[model samples]
Target: MSDLTRRAVIGASATGLAATVVAVGPPATAAPAPAAAVQPVTRGAALYRRGRFAKRRTRAFWVAGPGVRLSMKLVAVTDLSSGGARGSLRSFELTFRARRRGPEQGTYTVSRSQFAATSLFLVPTDASRRTYRAVVNNR
Candidate 1:
């Protein structure tokens, strides 16, 4: 074959090889994302029969002594009864207790829930019995 023809054939073959290399190249593969952790929930009659007991957490506290300070925590507010207007938290009760206290003459304040906005003032009614009365004022 002529030199010019041979050179032309070689150039065409190089171009075809370049095209084939590009077509057969491996595609990009994305890395798999990590799996999320899942938490299991209790179900069945315990959910319906227990009702609030199933979803709500019950807390208790005891106070003794003359001068003692106590605090209550507002955990969560849930609808006690169902099948009412949506976005209404009815039959909701605040859960809290005075922190344990020993005999002493002192006064403490209880923080109210955001929704209810109540203020409770605790005062020792009896010095000997170490008993207190919580005065609740709903704002």
Candidate 2:
């Protein structure tokens, strides 16, 4: 073959080889496995010191606002009886730390009956800042 033709053929072959190498490169590594699910906190019925019942699951919902976030802990749930019927009631305490406001803590009582739940919020103003009570009723 002529020198010019041979040089052109070699240049084309080198370009093809480089393209093949790039096309056959190893794939990227697989993504990592997802994190495990967190287990829910369960306080047995015995802690209520009330009537007998099965184990109940207590869950907290963290609410985030403009400049503050509240961590509410489901501390206790008690069954209140009025008349001959029983109702499910829940007591939750909220501890809040504000970015530009004062730190505050409060207790809320929530009650659920049939399909409705209500919460009453209370704050302490005296030395009794330790414990606060709320009464929630089902509608």
Candidate 3:
């Protein structure tokens, strides 16, 4: 009705809202800190060290892609390092076996327990045997 009455009503409404918010209190916990962003492993030679995979001899690599969820076994891990002009040696190869002869040559997200997920360009060396190879050469 009057300005004074309107002001009084507005003040009461504001105070009520503030009280309701305070009663609710903060969240039980701080959300959960989102989730630590996981940086995909990019360095192939570093991540898939020959020594590490060679010893396991039974590593399982899960390939993630559109309409593709394949579990390939790590059949072999070869060391293809050679002496360069400067005597630098950095090269290795990983051989994986799949159940079917598909998922041709392309970049796939491969994941294993030894390291984080990484994008590896895979090439099908033998379609009949369902084998894939990924050569990691670091200069």
Best lDDT among the predictions, by candidate number: 3
lDDT of 1: 0.38
What TM-score does candidate 3 reach?
Answer: 0.56
Identify the runs in model 2 with alpha carbons over 4 angstroms from their true place: 1-57, 63-68, 81-85, 88-120, 123-132
Q: How many Å off is the CA of 83 in candidate 1?
A: 8.0
Tell me the tens digit of each residue's lDDT in model 2 across 1-139.
Answer: 6467888999999999999989989788977655432222324433332221122224342322234344433344444334423544332222222123322433332323231232234443335343333333323
Please state every model's RMSD to the true fold in angstroms: 17.6, 14.4, 9.4
Q: Candidate 1: TM-score? A: 0.22
* Candidate 3 lDDT over residue span 39-105, tens digit each: 2346645565556556656777797665667999889877653542332234577788888765868
Q: All candidates' TM-scores?
A: 0.22, 0.26, 0.56
Residue 2 lDDT (model 2) = 47
Q: Tell me the whole-model lDDT of each prediction, alpha carbons only.
A: 0.38, 0.38, 0.71
TM-score rank, highest first? 3, 2, 1
Off by over 4 Å in 3: 1-45, 81-89
Residue pairs in clash, model 2: none
Worst 10 residues of 2 by lDDT: 48-57
Query: Which digits, one per residue and each the tens of the lDDT, describe model 1 over residues 1-139?
Result: 6466888999999999999989989877976554432212223332222233214344323322224334433333344333433333222333333334333433333322332122333344454433444422111
Better of 2 and 3 by TM-score: 3
